[model samples]
Target: MAHPYLAYYCLNISTIPENSSYQSSLSSLLSSISLYATSEFQFNKLQKFLNISDPLYGLQLCHGDVTTEVCRECVATVAKSLAVVCSRKLVALIWYDECMIRYSNESFFSTKNVLPGFALSNIQNITELHRFDQLVNTMMIDLESQASEVPAGSKKFKTKEANLSELKMIYSLVQCTPDLSTTDCNTCLQEAIGTLPVCCNGKQGANVLMPSCYVRYEVYPFYNIIDTAPSPATGLPPLPPRELEGMMNFFFLIFF
Candidate 1:
């Protein structure tokens, strides 16, 4: 089951009054977003409920590789949970494994938000620290570039893998909300990547989750390789051989 990794509410802001116009609008907004999950056009929805004097702006995003069924489940889960979890705050954000849901009294669309981010890391540490760190940094930088270069309407997501040694490999993924522009997406990713050394340096695996974008890496594959495309939307070329030479093994080693 998908669980929330983080839940943030703007505590300084006033909470919505029970049965008020704002509350009604919020309910309608979330309901519409959840209902749209069944659509085939895209896995995200940016919506607003403007019937009331105070409007509510919201968005829902599912990870690029999840199935439609999973996306629907995740969206529904967060939509219902946010109201209770956030205590009817004027602004709130929640992150789940399969999806993310956020809403505010004011419009936040197309803006880059990085505050209230969180990081998760494996308890185990890598034995080969320096080499592993170098490989992860290189791969993440490449993935960030590719993910952020997509056109505005396309999914800004990318995944990559590299063999760290004959017995081990590294898998990574980076993503941004499609609504963000290329420069904003790139900036968000860079900030997320900068958190690794502070939060998960030398760990076997780690994830940086932000409101605008996220970056993750692990020794075992945590994402669906088949569900996601192998390249970004712009068809950018992969890292040159010289850049990856001596740091990564292109061939996969199978152990029976």
Candidate 2:
């Protein structure tokens, strides 16, 4: 029994300095740092979003389906690890919960990478492989249609339904960089969906992610709370998003 509310968000950026000015490059990278934090899940309080400008190139996206704590943790982790991994690549991707942070010299918004990034599974497998596979196929079809129909603005969405015995649910989350138009986000996600069969195969859970977008499926609940005004269900400042299911889960990402 894992905690159902354990979602997070992160942003990662990588840049190549033509003149190799580390100072300016570092400043640009740090500009988006403050923009990443927020007060989105304070029980009674409203979700407070932070919007700060950066000196260099950057973009931020929260999956709109997670708690503030998880969001903060994921962003903090990327902020800490980005420099070590990217090391002046001028571009990078840091994957975490349901959301991600990324930036590059060349904009990736509204674009599909089709680079075949990665694919893997947990050690465990379902007892009924055939039934589980069939269910997953049906679930993906439904998710694709729903997500395709969501209004463009952020392309940050998470969806789930009890697939097998009702007790076992199928969950997923998908997102694209805010910098991209809605259509591009949709396009990127479609590309990701195409690889699910090759990537995760018959595994219990898995995720497919690119710098701009990603999709995931698991057997357990893996999203945090969202801050909303109680009475009217009034909307608060927009927060990030994340969701996962079964043993699989959402992937928070940072891009640069």
Candidate 3:
């Protein structure tokens, strides 16, 4: 069977040649950071921008759940693989594994840009339209609160549990590159949130992703918490049922 998270769609923008230096630097940077990471950001002015002629740079934040080896491997693949896949497109994206990679000459930082993104239905949907709307809307509200209250320093991504009732629960996650301005990040995600009704209307599971952010909800946990890192009792509550949804079908949105 296919690896988890393999059946997902993606969206992104990348400025390759102009940002050659950015990709080069990205390769080096990933070689340094530990375990899984999920982020897409541009480089600081001090660092050499990827492509000289373009003068634009790229940045990325990997999903925090990934292991160091996997993150490095994924990034490396983007450096090589994207070149072959995207060919000459200045802005491109590829959904490779649980790792989504993208590079763009555009100032993606703090700037919210969305598109007519896509969603692959799970061959399931509720017959009652009204009930469906309520379920999706309510779940989104809960996820929004958790995302805003995300604890970690750089990672503003969160996977959470919502007690729909004693009998049922929902697993969800909301994430934005820490570099994103709250407004831009929130807006981009809100767009993804908005897509639920239109695209995933009745589907049992869906991943709504935008260029700068994404939200996912399903019956199972879809993350690989890198460590036994105890969550401090500040905002995020314990994984409901105190169970780590081992083995995630991560929907990484790659951009090149």
- Tell me, by TM-score, which candidate is best: 1
> What ranking emerges by TM-score with the best candidate at the front?
1, 2, 3
What alpha-carbon RMSD in Å does predicted model 2 have with respect to the real structure? 8.8
At residue 143, candidate 1 shows an lDDT of 93
Per-model C-alpha lDDT, please?
Answer: 0.76, 0.51, 0.51
Query: How many clashes (backbone atoms < 3 Å, residues ≥3 apart in a chain or on different chains) does model 1 have?
Result: 0
Candidate 3 per-residue C-alpha lDDT over 1-256 given as tens digits, one digit per residue, 9 for 90 to 100 = 4432332222234443444555565444333321233233211211224455543334444555566566666656654555565554445444443455554555455565565354444445545557545766787776676565544235657665554445445556677766666566667678777776666665555676565667766544455433322442123343531232232323323222
Off by over 4 Å in 2: 1-19, 36-56, 225-256
Error of 3 at 102 (Å): 1.6
Off by over 4 Å in 3: 1-52, 126-133, 149-153, 164-168, 225-256
Query: Across residues 1-256, which tens digit of lDDT does each residue of candidate 1 receive?
Result: 3233443445446888998888878888888888888645345555555565688888888888778888898899888888778866888888776688888888878888887677777667899999999999999999989988998768888898887898787888999988899999999999989988887877888777788888888776666766665633322333332332322221111111
For this target, which candidate reaches the highest lDDT against the unseen true structure? 1
What is candidate 2's CA lDDT for residue 155? 39
Model 3 lDDT, residue 69, Cα: 62
Evaluate model 3: give its TM-score: 0.64
